[model samples]
Target chain A: MSIQIEELCKRYGDKVLFEHLNLRVEKPAVLWAPSGWGKTTLLRILMGLEQPDGGRVTGVGRVGAVFQENRLCRALNAVQNVALVTPDGKGDPEAIRRDFGLLGMQGAALALPTARLSGGQKRRTALLRALWAEADTLLLDEPFTGLDPAAMQQAAALLRQRCAGRSALLATHDRAAIQALGWPVLVLAGQNGPESGGK
Target chain B: MKPVWVQRAAAVLFWLAVWQCAAMAVGQEVFLVSPVAALRALVQLLPTADFWGRVWFSSGRILLGFGLGAGCSVLLAAASAKIRWVDILLSPLMQLVKATPVASFIILALVWVRGRSLSILISFLMVLPVLYGAVRTGIQSTDPQLLEMARVFRLPRMRRLRAIWLPAVLPAFHQGCSVALGICWKSGVAAEVIGLPDGSIGDALYRAKITLSTGDLFAWTFVIICVSALFEKLFLWILDRAVKRVTGEEAAR
Candidate 1:
């Protein structure tokens, strides 16, 4: 029902990243942290890609993620890329195509390899892949990078719709995207609460 | 402003002309044969059932050896990439295979395997180290970030291979295959020459040599080149199609 991170500690050499960092998420939320402040690192740890120096994560079952990079299979089209994480990799093709269309990816964008996609299109594809994936928790790192204002708003709306009732953490520095999603913000380098206006 | 293919053809014609001039200068049938004579000899051999039988025998064995070697190398490379101890243990053996001469391997293999299988053994040995090194490097060079992404999404092993590993590994594997194809053909034919397998292209070559029929010898050499080139093209074409199927390139298009 919820994801819990307890007393997590991570560091690089002498640079302290997180000392006894703790957070919990019951619904879709924003992780607001400055660049080089280990937001990506924290998300990677949550996604089980990296091990924290200390502490254990609990209740993170069946995670889906949008990594810092788009990370779509370059040879696959947007629809096929989304289908890759689906149950038995058999997501409904029409449904994936419709979702891509909704995200303003129509015609060749849906058919062409993600390698040929623009940065925003690729970012949107990555978002859809994570949302379409079979998972209870979602970790997205800078999910709005390279998106225009309209596309960012569309993506935020999609994130809101998909992440409802699921424990999700979207790490981004985009203030506009934060306000668009209107999710509670957890500041990584400062306080770990929903107090800031994401500025 | 000639087309690239036209340019290539012109270059080939120039080389043939130079070869023809050199043959005329040598003026000894035993030492040199004109390209025209070789082509004439090839035309004569084309209608003969015996020539086709020899072609089939050598081609089948060599192709089998190449296939076996390619398959084993991929498996071994995957193993070496995944397991550090396997890499450590296999490093020396692969290096040894690479360093050893083809003649030595063919001669040594004669004592172990019959002459019929000598070409296969030599070709297999020739391909093993080259492809093993290539596919291993390809596997090792897989993008860590993509792997992490796959892990997070919990992609099944087969899906992971199709989406991530195969694409990363294919280019290097293809290059390795190209190199191995040429190597296997050279060594396979050489092994046949040494072993003198009955009714083989190598035996025909030996007979031509003993009889001092330079035209037949040149024609047989030309036949080997043509067959090897044709097989290389055909194999690479199939591999490309397989890659497209695995990566869903056709569906994407």
Candidate 2:
């Protein structure tokens, strides 16, 4: 499945965020943009959380997203948070535990409430939640925000393994992360709209 | 420094002392009863079968009313949040209930409801609007960011409810219940005093008033305060546990 955006336009009161932006997601890709370049807004629109000022996007079916903010339920533990997005909330405990362990989360960190988790742990929880969701497309916004270099590499590897054969877009400006994934890059250039590039 | 509970106990003793002095200065048993006299009256009443009977009679009916009110308010609040027409219809009615006086409702309800069920109906009415407002506000104010995440992930209805909605709304519900519990007891007993249901605590209170037994009045008032506080604590504790179980947070732990 592919997502196609046609002449999408969005703007604030005076500042324009997106102007005639167009892009496609036929494979997993990286959305590379400088800070304040409206990458988050584009992802929000794609996730159907916001309405575009003018344009059409098609083939964006059931979506899974890792928000800029780690949106894990504060009262739920890391495992429970991942299970929350599964169909009927019936994720297998063993598989989830193994996945957490792969991302360096185990024991007390996995069982404690997300509120008590460190920033890096929370980000991993958010990523795992999206990966576990029964969704057709994935939209990740700065998914490795607080991760250290080692954790970032682990998360990148996890994302690559889970996102295979699925339409995914990882929005980040981190050069190291962009190189880590080595996926096609869709750059959101201000005013000039988006420039598509391939690795 | 002493513990917080000890400080609170000291404060309570100081107030009791002030009350005792005031009662002695009045110098009339008909006008006032000292703390010791009220305690003595409480001790005398506790051993009697009738006292427990009256306590149970009032407590059971009032609690039933509270439970019913709580259930209906949650359902109605959800409906109001989901449907615009429901909110439009129920908003004014809830406002009117809040504005109307408890005594007026007790008197007006006397025409429609039997005397035995009067306290139950009164308590229900007293709790409904408060809880409805709290639940509605809670639902309305739920974090939009979390809601967006749920939608994007296509989380199922029940999962979204347990994970997102319950935690958002629980604090408000707890606050509402705290405020509603006291009103439920006060209005229920007032209804009983006015309706004079057979063998209710309010009936005894009415009898105490007619007989000019100030000690009985003080003793019954003390009992009401204690019971109300205890019920609030128990109800809130159960609510927290139930929410934890439903959300699978307890199982994860």
Candidate 3:
């Protein structure tokens, strides 16, 4: 099974983010690019959140994603946040608590609402939620933005643990994160418009 | 320094003194009764089973109306938020309810239904629009980012409602509830007064006015205020806990 993007074209008020871009994803690959290089636009297109101006995609099913922002439910605790996307619709608390622990969340931290979590902790919860959810394709967009080096490594290790041999796509500008995962990279198409601005 | 309650007590006493002075200056019970007379009347009525019956009668029907109004509004708002035609169809009706006077509805309702049910119908009409507006606004204001996340993760409808839509909708719902609670009571009581349902507080109030029993009127007014305030507090407390529990916010220990 594979996700194939064929001659995809997309634009925003004449700022073309993609044009005649054809790609095939048969294995887990890192989508490597600087900001505003249509990395997010591409991911959004893959998730079907945006429509390509021309062309079509195939074999992308049941997407699980960690958005550019942590986007955790501000009112829910870490366990509840993960449970929200669990396959059976409710995560096993003991298992999730353990998973969160390996990702560096402890007792009080796990119990606290996600709104109160530190940026790194929230980011980890978002990652764990996507990991735990049922999906044939996993998409990560700048998943390591707010983490310290130690936390970043822990996240990378956990990502590897859960995602090995799975069809996963990691999009990031973080060199260390890319190095830690050590996956093949696909640079996004540069903007085919007025000036190239890093977003 | 006095305890807070004691200070409050002193302020209440000062108001009573002013009220008594005003009543004496008026020199007629028809214009105003002293606080003491109202209290005496209240105490005299307290021992009677009829007083309790009357209290139960008005409170139950008003609450029934409130519950139905609030329930229907939330459900309809959920539908209208999704389907454009439903919103468009209901727009004029909601606007008409808001525009019409409570007395007009009460009198109009009396022509179709029994006077006893007037309070319920009026209260429902008064509460529906405010809540519908609140829920729709809340649904509209939900973060597009979170919704996109839910879509990507394939979160089920029930889970999305609980985790995403619910937390987003609650604050506005709370605001609407607060405003609607006060309004439902006022409009319900107003309807009762106009419709003069037998054995109701409104009927009793009408009798008091005709008989010039100023103390009875004052005492009943106090009862209405106390009852409505108590209900507002209770409903708000329940709503707060429900919102917290469903959304998985751990209540402060």
Candidate 4:
């Protein structure tokens, strides 16, 4: 029902990203980390995209993730992109369309190729894809990068609303989002944790 | 930088005039035939049943070969991309095929099989390398980040293939097919000309050559070009739809 990371060790050549870093997650948690400090790498490792040399991960069921980059299928429309990962292949297009509307996407934007959408809109689509997929655990890597403050707040609120009663790990340095999320922070080591100063 | 159609038309007219001039200068039908003479000969050939049989014989086998070659190359490319050893294994053989002359293959094919299968084998041989190279590059060029996303999301194999791999592979494959289609026809027809398979266009071309029927030779050349162009257009149209269907994109006309 939850994720367990046990003595995870990852290294890139001479640099050690994580050495014996361990954590247990039973609820939504914010992974507070600065830029280029292996936040994405950590998320990747959790999602089974990478292998830790010295340790093992266990108890992560089906995972849904918003990757650091908007990894949407450019050929498909926003509705199709979300629908592609839905349970039983019965994803509700109308619901997805409605979600896009709330994220400031309207008119021809929803049906247009994801490649044609603005960066912020694409980010929202990736977020919606993760949030909508049938997964017990979610790994979101900087899911709110391109949005303005108001949009970011709205997205953060939506994430909190939908992510209830699920294990979700969000990686970001945004304090306002952190405050809005109101989730316990897991401060990563080295330059991994966010550089904090302003509110 | 003129419109392609206008430039094409100008080039065609210039060639036609030169052809007419050359035929007149030669003053004999044995060495050179005018474009008008060739067209007239084509008109005569069109009404005959033998012409259609020859067309069908050559085109059918050649196209069948191309289809088989395209299919096998894609499968090989996909397999090779996933398994590095397969690529290493295929590299030397594919290079040898590419470097060897078509004439050599045709002559060597005679030793292994009957003449009728020559065009098919030749077309298959000619098409494999082109498709393999293009599809391999396409597979290699697929966005790594998206692949990571697919892996994390635990997207099903079919879904990942339709959404990610196909879209990445198709554009380059399409381009390669464009070049390969022409090569297939040329090599196929050449094999037929050498092998002289019964009831094939190459036999007809050979007969025309032996009799010194310059006009018939010219007419057959025209027919070959038309067939090649038409096949390319039709094949590419189907290919475009297939790519669009897999990518979940809007189909083009």
Candidate 5:
């Protein structure tokens, strides 16, 4: 399934963000934009968190997202955080634990509250949670911000593996991350047309 | 360690000296009973079975009322925070409860409730508005961004409560409970004294007052203060532990 955003327009007071914007997202697509281009706002609108002044979003189903902030429950462990979004309550917590280990989390660190985790660890946990949740659509905003290069590569691979057959709309500034995932890119520049790039 | 103990002993001796001087200046035991006489009276009362029964009876009822008030406050705060209608509905009642005096509540309650239950009802009433306001403000102060994240993820209500609401509400709730517990004990005891239930500490204190046994009155008053402090410490200790367990933050202590 694909998400079709048609004539999407959003504004804040006197500032016009985007007017008569159109985008089509098929399975496993990446939405790329520079800072301050309203990518997060657009994603939020699609998720029904923000209602656009004018827009129609179709083909969104049970969205899971890594918000710009690492919104992990400060009190819960990583496994419990992921389990919170899973409908069947059958999210493989052991696998999520292993993924956290692979992402350089270890020892009591994983068991510790997310509040105690370092910035990178919390970000990785949030990303993992979004990917692991049972959702047909995943919206990730800067899913690899605090990760080192190697960890970012691992995270990209993890995202690719977990998001198979699911539509993904990833917003990121890192060109290298965009290339590493090899996702078809939709670039927004200056509220004009979206520039398409390498798949 | 020795110096610390010596300092504490010196402090107690200093207070005793001051109290003895005050008692001597008064030239009457009725006005201000000496600490020595009060201690002697406490020792005499300690041997009686009725003392324990009085202590337990008052303590149990007041603690029960405090617990009920605290629990209901949490539930009501949650409901009020989630629904504007509930919040509007409860605002006037909370305001009225806060505005009313403890004595007034005790007097009004005497008409509707039996004398035995007066302390419990008064304590519950005294504590409820405090806990409700604290928990409500705590819930209101939660980060909007985190709630948005939870909404997007569609987290289960119980998980959201455990992970989000509980952590946000705990510190304020703990503070409220600490304050409310002290007030509950004070109001409870005052209500009991007014009502004069059969086997309660308040009844004993009332009897001491009637007989003008200044020593016994002072001793009973001291015991009440000690019990109230002890209850506050124990309840807050348990509450801190529960908050830490829920938020998974050991530093909550």
Candidate 6:
């Protein structure tokens, strides 16, 4: 089923974010927008973290995501973080450790707190967590932020493999990411008016 | 670099000097005992079998009370955090416990419990509010974003607790335990003194006070401080080690 948004309106006091907006997301998709375009707000609404002022959102399943922030448990390692979202009986700690290795994270690096990790390492941990979740729908909010070119390619491949035949909504500013994923893009530009910098 | 023992000795000497000066100014052994006299009294008491028994009796009850209070507080705080009704139900009780004087609790507990057990009840009461408040605040202050991630992932209760709640709350809980342990000892001894429990340090101190043995009083007080400090150090060391182990395993896995 597709996630359908109809007559959606969001306002923070007098400042309106979206008004009478409508969109339908089917299959794996991307919502490309620049910073401050309310991409996160929209995602939050879809995730039920925020309630839209006036609108309807439907067809959201068990959702997993790399949030705008990494949101990895700072005290837990990559394997533990990944295992947290894997289905209860399905989680394999060794498998997660192997996956981290495959993602180019050293065993020692994966054994440290996320606080001690570099930004890209933490990003990969967060990505792994989401990818390992038993969710029908995946949300990626600038999921490739901290990765270098090589890491970005590896992460993109990981996401592509995991998101195959599944619904995904990726919000990103990186045109390269959009091109890499090759998913249908819905430009959220000019939807919130000219003064509203979707970029 | 100075060794830790040297710094500790220096601190003890500094305090002893101040105490000696105060004792000299008082000019009466009945009113104030000198550190030297107190040390002599301590040496005399240390060899007695009764002294060891009293120490054990008091330490055991106080530690038991502290352990019970900590366990109950953690459980209650978790329940209250999860349920609004539980929070509402506990709010007034927590406030009452916080507001009530330790002496009042000791006196009240004496009517309901044996004199020997009075310290246990009093210490439990003193420790509860500290642990409850700290645990609740820790739970409340956990990052909502992380909790949201847990929800999205449908993390099980035990896993969620280990991964998110335990790490978030352990620091605050350990802090509360540190503070509450000190308070429990003080309040517990105070209760024992008032109740005059047999085979207890507080009873010995009470007897010393009645006999105008100021040196014995000072010696007993010193023992109490030492015991309290030792217990705090041991308990906190164990807690620190446990937290490190748990978080370390999580980090390693």
Q: Which candidate wins on lDDT?
A: 2
Q: Which stretches of candidate 5 lie above 4 Å from their native place?
A: A87-91, A190-193, A197-199, B1-14, B24-27, B244-253
True contacts kept of each: 0.91, 0.82, 0.91, 0.88, 0.74, 0.68
TM-score, structure 3 vs. true: 0.93
lDDT of 2 by residue, B77-152 (tens): 9999999999999999999999999999999999989888999999999999999999998898788888878878
- In candidate 2 the C-alpha lDDT for residue B121 amounts to 96
lDDT of each: 0.89, 0.89, 0.86, 0.87, 0.86, 0.86
Q: lDDT value for candidate 2?
A: 0.89
Error of 6 at A142 (Å): 0.9
* Docking category of candidate 4: medium
Candidate 3 residues lying further than 4 Å off, grouped into runs, are A189-199, B1-10, B250-253
- Estimate the TM-score of every prediction: 0.95, 0.92, 0.93, 0.94, 0.91, 0.87
lDDT of 3 at B3: 100
Mark the regions of model 2 whose C-alpha exceeds 4 Å error after superposition.
A7-22, A34-37, A53-55, A190-196, B248-253
For every candidate in turn, the CA RMSD to the true structure comes to 2.1, 2.7, 3.3, 2.6, 2.6, 3.8
Where does candidate 4 stray beyond 4 Å? A189-199, B1-4, B250-253
lDDT per residue as tens, model 5, B175-238: 8988998999899999999999999989999999999999999999989999999999898898
Ranking of all candidate structures by their DockQ, best first = 1, 3, 4, 2, 5, 6
Q: State the fnat of model 1.
A: 0.91
lDDT of 5 by residue, A1-199 (tens): 7788998899899887887788888877788777778999999998889998886888987888999899887777777777667775447777778878777776788787787788888898899788777787999988999999998988998888887787889998898898888888887875744766543
Q: What lDDT does candidate 6 reach at residue A197?
A: 21
Q: State the DockQ of every prediction.
A: 0.80, 0.69, 0.77, 0.77, 0.61, 0.51
Query: For residues A78-196, what per-residue lDDT tens digits would candidate 4 score against the true structure?
Result: 88888988975549888888887777777798889998999998999899999889898999988889888888988888888888898998999888888878888887756323233
Best by TM-score: 1
Cand 5, B chain, TM: 0.93
Which residue pairs overlap in candidate 2's backbone? Answer: none
Task: State model 6's lDDT.
Answer: 0.86
- How is the predicted docking of candidate 6 categorized under the CAPRI scheme? medium
